[model samples]
Target: MGKYDLLAKDIIKKVGGKDNILSLVHCVTRLRFQLKDESLADDEALKQTEGIITVMRSSGQYQVVIGNHVPQVFADVCRIANISSEKEGGQKKMSFREKSLDLISGIMMPAIGILCACGMLKGLNSILSYLGLYSNEDGIYILLNAIGDSIFYFFPVVIGYNTAKKIEMNPFLGLIIGAALCYPTINGVDVPLFGHVINATYTSTLLPVILIVAIAKPLEKFFNRVIPDMVKTFITPMLVLLISVPLGYVVIGPLANMLSNGISQAVLSVYKISPIAAGFLVGGFWQVMIVFGVHIVLVVLCITNIISGTPDPILAFTTFVTFTTTGMVLAMWLKTKDKSLKQIALPAWISGFFGVTEPAIYGILLPRMKHFVISCLCGAVAGAATAALGLKYHTMAGMGLFEIPALLDPAQPGVSLVRAVIAAGISLVIGFVVSFITFKDEEPSQTKGEEIVSEKCKKEVIASPLSGKVKPLSQINDSAFSNETLGKGIAVTPSEGKVTAPFNGTVMMLFPTKHAIGFMSDQGCEVIIHIGMDTVRLDGKYFEAHVKEGDKVKKGDLLITFDIDAIEKEGYSLDTPVIVTNTNDYMDIIAMMESGSTVHCGDDLITIL
Candidate 1:
């Protein structure tokens, strides 16, 4: 905490002191702040401040994207600002897709491992029971049942804890409501309330628990406010349990569950009516929804199907969407001439093959508009074709090519392997053709006609840490870079060397993993050169170093030379990001024209105010 004092003060000063911040909250990797006056804050300067990686303003909240150490910074921010660590509970204005993904990630991340483990256990139990190796009456079966079934049977408990955290409520009380839902006497009691008899059991049922928690949350807050502090510790929990839980079980649970079930059934009915329409809706919107974290509702529906032998259509469609992204990557590989581009596309193929398309979508295709649109359209068409032909997915597993076997349900004679293959092949060919038709041709290292012409004398700007070729910052991921907050910087791919010092500067901080380095220029600007995403796995094997922490280096000195061959061999690209770590301190950042080998050391590759 003491060591964090410097970082805390630095943030306060950079953000215009403690007074400027109105509210703050943190999710695992970022500190999301609401400010009183965004104009009074220098976002670029804040990004350059020590310990801050990037500043993003979106969704009405100023998001400080700190990689992994955000929790510490968040704690420090809370201490300095003298505010409760809890965020104010209010409605957030996120698109449906955004909310869905957030809810899904929140629910799934903490419990996915458990889901997998329990699913495996359940599968084993089924095998043993079928083979007569063990009886359901056996002690092993009972123990395993308790172990595996605890998660799904007591799902409310897990959902309660996670949802409470997401909405910034007391987790303890959330679990209490969850436990109450499972309370034997209460869950079994049936009363004819309003029109329908409340005969639904809480165990292994979704409607009751989720609805109760949703309703109970607000009720918990109301009780806390009205009750006296001295008596609240005991009286509040008692009151909420007495009023909220029963009220939820009798009214909210039954009603909400019926509504949700109706919605789920409606979705299924629609899919059954026209598989093609279902496929298009799920495929086109799957990744889009997933990106925002709202895909959880769909995930829960799928899990429900898994537990009850029912099936969900949305999950069935995601498999096709994943394959489509894979097809797009292969298309890029077939179309691109840049050696580095091929290197990136290779791993993207592997990741996509296994159903993790974030690296591929965000890394490879989304950067290019033609490719992105082409792949998505092809995916939509392919998904529709597959669904129209009555293709079905068998199990809930990773959504990729490998899952093809798991997806095949022999009983559903309407689905088959051949149809999947046909669908996959059609997707790939269409994606490839579309990409080939629209792909841009390879250009020279520097386009003379497009280069920005400057009247100032040409200072000898050195080559960026990345070397194969360079692209304008505007062409790279995230337009925020071009906003000049990162100061003037260029994107480059090092062909045959490692990053080195463009000019003399102090080594501000060398990341523990050695994949990145930050330096402060004599003029007080900060610069960062990061080799690649997840390149830390290289483990310094190919990094030939010339400097250590706190050591000063001159212009033209080698800071690090990487074995491009080794890196490429290990299935990684060498696209390095050389950024001005502290661009906010300056008024203006200017990029010089791209040039040839005539450039010298200590030249102005970029200019700062």
Candidate 2:
């Protein structure tokens, strides 16, 4: 067995076993599962599991975050579960939004690495030319540019193959279909088909091939069902190609091309209205949109703009988000006294600098409320500057610093390169400086020696963190808390929005959403005080934290304050879960109060033994 076998098995069991998974796939760092019932998966157990970093339910998939080692872990997961690594049938019905996310994520995820590599190559080529190390006519320049441009030139084939596999069709057929569209003989040849002149090339096109392959699956199935087994193999493909290829050229291709053009024009029109506003809106909300999986919509827009031979300002504007996120992580690394947190933040910053911000967002920024806001605000300023200066990328590039190369305009090379560098510098400086200044380090009330002594002692009782009516953990709507996966806990429906320290303890973690806080009691009990159900969506709008991680506090000290009416109006439940994260370390955890009984802050709510 492999090293991750046990961890894989544990993950499978915790995700409601193999039966609950309809399809499974892994991207660079996440194990994306299309589960039978999303709610059945043990989110808390998976999060607390040894190998997993976290759990995210987004893009119509339950994503198990495993960081860089996910590919190997994914292999072990597939091996142990006896499941196919490739896309499979039996996808449960999904909403339109979910379906769109799944499709876009599937198509785009596989290409990101190569996209980054090519983008970097292109950028390096431009740098050499600008420095007079190599001219555009040089053999090295031609070879490198060809290498970088090959993917975009044949983008339809790549997209078609991936989209075909996602829709469970013959990927080879999809490739053939894409090739047919781009074939020299067919392209630019105005053939009179059904009174329409079919004279379009498919190279670098986005929508047509995907639409063609999507329709081809049902057609392929139809042909297979009617054709005899003896000749089905050849005949089915032949029929599919004959019908799909011509129909694609005559109708599907044209319609999709028009749609792509329309979308591109619409985005350009909007950007022209107020470039700064567009930049600010995109840069500020880009990360937030990513959290909700809505950012995939912009992927289509970017591709459409690139295919239409227009520079993609939408992508250009949003590039600041990664740098800003990186800045925040770096600031956290510098400001934090916790060695372990610094270790995590360092790598997350590096990842963000290279264009991948998931680590920084989830590992560092999301956990630090002020740092995240600072990053977003800085990103917005940089994005506005980038747009105002008319910065754009001719092709889709890897985000963050890696995308600098993509910003070089082949036609106006030096000017665009200079603009890109300026924008990037602005983004990096502002993101780092703003975050460094605004994000404060935690100040513990007790000395290190005192904290160590407190850790050695055992606390007999746990007090309520909020003045509210008490309820059983099982009664909470959230499965993670209700299942007691983190530990034995109690819930409170708060009448007041203030959360106080239930015991004299050091804060372990304070989530960036300002909705959750983790505390390690001086008496050695670890607790998590989550403010509300799904309040992470609010993005700290109605929430405020008074303490930072590592801060020590006394019982009844104000930890956080929130607006009850505001949060409720925003559609968030006020049922707070006060959990003992280290439940296994204790013999028993008993609730002192009954359900529906009102309790005051610092009142004995739980007893530990």
Residue 80 in model 2: lDDT: 88
How far out, in Å, is residue 286 in model 1? 3.1
For model 2, where is the 10-residue window of minimal lDDT?
Answer: 451-460
| TM-scores of all predicted structures | 0.57, 0.72
Q: What lDDT tens digits, residue by residue, belong to model 2 across residues 416-525?
A: 87888788788877888887777776665678867655554455688999998999989887656676755787999998989999888899988766788888887788
lDDT of each: 0.63, 0.81
**Over 4 Å off, model 1:** 1-149, 184-197, 226-228, 290-297, 300-309, 385-396, 399-440, 448-450, 453-609
Q: Tell me, by TM-score, which candidate is best.
A: 2
lDDT of 1 by residue, 1-609 (tens): 655677876676555456556557665345666654343345767655756656655545566655345667777777876766644434334457545544555444556546655654654555466557877889998897688667777777777666666655677777787777777766667767667677656655555655566666787788889998889887876776788776887777778667767767876888878788879877777766544434556777777655444555567666667677777787778778888889878877666766666556655666676667667777787678777756654444434665454345534322456676777777667666766677764676555533422211223233354445665656544333433334457766666665668667687767545667777655455677766544655556777667777878776677877778778888876665567655444455566647232233334466654
Task: Tell me how far candidate 2 lies from the true structure as C-alpha RMSD in angstroms.
Answer: 10.8
